[model samples]
Target: MTTLRDIALIAGVSGATVSNVLRNRGFVGAETSARVREVAQRLGYRPNPMAQALANGRAPTIAMVFSDLANPFYSMFALEAERAARRRDHFLLVCHAAKPDGTLDTAYLGAVAGRLSGGVLILGSDLGRADLLSAVPNGVPTVLAMWEDAADHPSLPCVTLDFREAGRLAADHLLALGHRRIAVLAGARGDRVSHGARLEGATARLREAGVLGGATLEEDSIGGGHRAAMRLLEAEPRPTAILATNDLLGIGAIQAAGERGLAVPRELSVVGITDIWLAAEMRPALTTVDIDTRRIADASVNALLDLIAEPDALARDALRIVGRPSLVRRASTAQAP
Candidate 1:
């Protein structure tokens, strides 16, 4: 096994310097730190996490419980969270609490708590508030990355996006572009769901413009968007604009439009939320509401770290961090034809 000493020798530094770089606990020269990490990576040197945990009396890992592993939005959040954790010399243990049907798997969720030590971050949920909270282990520092429509846990801090505002912004943009016949594609229809919040926000703005809008509840996937778009595009008075709940759905909408011989931004306009990387690269380039996953990741990580550093603070007021999303206009949206 490659040891710290081996990495130090390869990087021309002392083992203590290598240790500092690995632990992220002390200051090390930037150049030396880079060299040590590079050499360690080349040597495939992995610290024995269990042994280190035993020695330190705590794990240097963060547990993340996600409701939807398939959702691109959640997937992006996971990637950013992993990146943020690595910056703190920690690794991530991802646990999927929701099953394929979007219901909470209580047994799996309860089992995850015992495996975690340092901190936990919960993102998205489709279960009852009580059940979700009950599954989470108490006494562990925890942060909620996405706010759920449930009673808040006293010990958990929350970092979330202004999803309603994001929805409003998307609607305002399409309305400003003079598209009165608008349709929103979302996962569900209810105030309790985040998708509903976005829909309501958009509807509020659309209503103000004297444009009655429509909504379709679908799977919230690329395929779902495609199927929904096919139906919407075939309606008597086809919607000139579509607002998807996410980028994946937006891409699907674009595809559906193409299949119907409609040109984007000329015949049909589309906007999406979450601004995933693929949005900018898609044909016609998706106009989207940027959810700022990086900022959310940073806030979630910082909240967890704060809880880990000061457990007593959990007894005080809970910390609430909210990120605002902005609209990114691209080639996909234009004035009504």
Candidate 2:
């Protein structure tokens, strides 16, 4: 098997020089560095991650923990994050926190917490517990994405999206369309960020408009939306419009309405949050709130880089960042029937 030593021998440089050139560390003449890189590429030399970590006391990779990778929202965030990391010359390692049974796995997280330099980014939800935040190995910084506030761990920084405002926007848009009976399809109640704040905002808006009494809450996924919408449709006073917390739920609600022989925007209207790409291409082109995942990813990466460069800066004192959701009008919503 080809190794760094073989590359070094062929390039006529010492092993130490080859290592330094590969890592872009210490001082190596430009000509020597180029020669080593060319020879290493030709030999297909692969650096041992463990040895590199040991030598530098830090891993070249960062870790990102999310609830589900199958969701388009999370996938877009990961894509933008990976791009941001590459621009700064770093690697990103993704870990899905939920197992097949949909339970949090702490043992898996603890096992790989030791070998990372660029810190960790938690997306979708918390790390299953507050204590887990503090348990991050020393020298490993942590950041929360799409979460409101870190209660006990002030040291941990966060990049939040205004989910509450997003919910309010959804409700207000449907209300303005003259829909008095509006239903909300929400994420799991356990997910405090999206479910709690978002629902509260929608509720507040509805109450002010005297429509809160008729609103219903459903689960976040497509299947959940179908079930919940089916129940609502069977009620004495069915909702004229439904506000889904995410686009996935909104799409499901549309399908459920079709099964019930209801024409969209004629018998029922639907609005979704998170203007995922697919939302615009749906049969009626869903009306939704854009979360701007790319912007969130860029800001999070930049904030972490700043923190890593200035360790002593107070966490709160550092810039607090959030992305705002904007309503996008489409064919799925119209005046209430």
Candidate 3:
């Protein structure tokens, strides 16, 4: 195997100089740095990450933990975060917490603790895992994605969209079209941040409009959405419109409507959050809310970096990053028939 010593000898520089060039540490002349890099590349000298971490007393890698990656909504967010991390010359380690029963495994907490460095980003946490916040060693910053408040851990920064506003917007759009009866397809029961805020916003809007009925909370999946919509459709006075918490549920609702031989827009209108790629290609293009996943991801990585720089700053103040949602009108919604 080609070693740093070999590269340094070929580049006519000291081994320490080569190490500095590779790690971008201690200043080296531009010409010397370039020569060292070329020699290292030609020799295929791969720097040992473990040695680098030990020498620097830290790892230049961040960790991201999410409830579920299957949901396109979360997938988009992950992609954005990954891109942003890469841009900053950092590595991202993702941890999937979604279990078969849709609950987080506490065992992963130990794994996350073991790789502590750079920072940590958590999505969709619950009270059961609240204790894990304390496990984060002091000085290692953390960011909570899509959570409303950082329960006992005020030290952690939070980055999330205005989920309540998203819900209200969905309800308001349906109500504006003269649809008195509406139902909401919610995410998992324990998903407090995104799902809770959305459901509250919808319910509040419905009540204010005076034509408010009720909503059905379901999992954030196609199957869950189909079942929720199916039950709502079987009600005495079926809803004329449905507000799905995410695009996956919204698409599933549309599929359910088709199976029941119902005509979309002409009979029922479906609105979904997160205008993902597939939304536009549906049989009837969906009218949904656009949550700029890329922007969110970029902001999240920046926030994590900021936290790493000043972990105490996050502990002293709350950082709430809110992203706006814009409605994309399409063939899926229309005036009440």
TM-score list, all predictions? 0.79, 0.82, 0.82
lDDT of 2 by residue, 1-337 (tens): 6777898899998988998899888999999999999999998888787566657666656677787887887888899988987787677889886566455566666655545445777674534455445455666666667764323223567776777788889999999999998887776634333466666777789999998643445556778778777877786688899888788888888889999999998999999888888899899889998878788898887676665556654374243556688899998999999
Instruction: Please write out the lDDT profile of model 1 over residues 1-337, one tens digit for every residue.
Output: 9998999999999988998899896998888889999999999999977667756656778888887767777788889999998898778888887776556676776665535547778785454556556667667677877663223433356677767788899999998888988988876523344476677778888888999887787876788889989999998788999999778888999999999999998999999988988899998999999978899887888778777777775543365546678999999999998
For model 3, residues 123-228, the per-residue Cα lDDT tens digits are: 7533234454554555557777766433333446777677678778888899899998787777765444336676777789889999655667676677888888
Give the Å error, residue 222, model 2.
Answer: 0.6
Q: Between candidates 1 and 3, name the one with more favorable lDDT.
A: 1
Instruction: Predict model 1's lDDT versus the native.
Output: 0.80
Model 1 stretches with alpha carbons more than 4 Å out: 1-52, 125-128, 148-155, 189-194, 314-319
Clashing pairs in 3: none
Task: Assess each prediction's global lDDT (C-alpha) against the native.
Answer: 0.80, 0.76, 0.75
User: Rank by TM-score, descending?
Assistant: 3, 2, 1
Q: What is the lDDT, from 0 to 100, of the residue 124 in candidate 1?
A: 53
User: Candidate 1, 313: how far from true, in Å?
Assistant: 3.1
* Model 2 regions lying over 4 Å from their true place: 1-4, 7-54, 100-103, 114-117, 126-135, 148-155, 189-194, 214-217, 313-319
User: lDDT of candidate 3?
Assistant: 0.75
